[model samples]
Target: MSARIHKLIVGLTLALPLSCGGSDSDGGGKTAELTPGEKLCKSLQDYVTQCGAATPCDTALVQDCSSIVDLLSEPFMNGVSECINRGEGSMTACLTAGFGALTPTNAHTGLAASFCSECAFGAPGCEGAFFSEDNPDTAILGKAILPFSDSLVSEVSTDCATGLGCAGSFLSCTQGVIAQRAIPESTVQCLVDNLTGQAPPPPAGQETCVVEGSGGAGGMGGTGGNAGSGNASGTGGNSGSGNAGGTGGNAGASGGG
Candidate 1:
């Protein structure tokens, strides 16, 4: 990557915090250092705050306080670095690009929760999410659905951003996780129960995803779920039923043929 990014990655860790006996010497870049995730997240929040570009996917919104911590990890930072290294524009833009869209199976990124709750939830349309008092079920639906982010990441990598974060939703275009039935059925039932009545959707997709996530848990109905999720534990679902079911399940149920 670039020299600046190299400094940011390796050297920043060595830069002592002012609190840790480090001091400002001359007029220069702020002496204190932030980890890669912190740096990227700060840049993202700043971009969202200034730009108001929280549309299809708001890069700054955090559904839970815990997720902010989750968002900052080495792999995720690497993804961010990869995006920047290859000449992507801004932090948020690179995030939208999936470090520049590598996975053909998933598209339209900005899937995961934002790191900055203040900037994200306080933005404009976020009151409808976790803090909602109108219907607690709304949050339930949200929580029920978005865990796709985890399973998706789990299925692909231990890291969240490296997998579904880049894809932008819980539902993959390849139908890998769905076919495998990676998500719990209880979560599916919860989603089905709440989706219709709440009037609002999940804060974002774990299942309902960032760009266009297809809700694939069991509650989509036996026809829907069985059709979509092959319950693939990798190759088992892939060859046995994953792709076949994904393609055939809906059509067979509808019986268009």
Candidate 2:
């Protein structure tokens, strides 16, 4: 790598520990350890800086000079070293060429998130900046996560819709079977008696029970609850057979006197 690129990468990686909530004391919390992948990422960052500073590089130089750390596996580092030994261009040119090939794609979400987090913490004026927004590493992180987000959202929506439809149908069918079983007339009479017992008795002078429906209880089957007048409706009944059975009890037409 070019000296300038190496310098840039060193600056970034060294700053990362401090930027990512790391304290000076080793005893306080977990001491952060740099991983091989992280080291590679920093190395690639350095290469990009060097190349960008150098003259506009040829596409072939960019393609051939790509770093194993950035483009391929750790094992590819051997091949990368061989290419560097060949000395096709200045270190800056080779670094630039390799850096260009490490274009961000959604497969590297973790990498993209890491870079964004690092930038937000380390880079100036990066607070609240999204991968879509312009920043120092926009080209890198944006290319990685944006396409991934789109595909993931689409997949989740499709899966959720299918699951919801299946669950709703199963619930409806199960409730319908339960409602089909007839209840004994005695059970209904017992429910009515219990309900009336819970209510206050009529006054001694009052012979007939005069049901007075209050405005608050209007359209609520004398349950003394208000039906909401707003755009949002009150929770009245379930969508399945439970609703049908509840409504049938109140409807004189459905329940023969």
Largest TM-score belongs to which candidate? 1
After superposition, which runs of candidate 1 have C-alpha atoms over 4 Å from their true positions? Answer: 1-30, 59-75, 78-92, 100-257
Which numbered prediction scores highest in lDDT against the true structure?
1
**Residue pairs whose backbone atoms clash in candidate 2:** 62-97, 66-98, 104-143, 104-144, 105-144
lDDT tens digits by residue: candidate 1, 1-257: 99899988776566656435434444354666776656555544544454444442333232111234342234444565455444344433454334222231221123223311222333444434432436563343233223233434434332222432333432232233333444333333322232223222333323222221123332222233233323332211122243233322332132222
lDDT of 2 by residue, 75-119 (tens): 333322333334333333232233333333443444334333442
Per-candidate TM-score against the hidden true structure: 0.26, 0.18
Note the clash tally of each candidate: 13, 5
Question: Model 1 clash tally?
Answer: 13
**Per-prediction RMSD in angstroms?**
26.1, 36.3
- Minimal lDDT window, size 10, model 1: 205-214
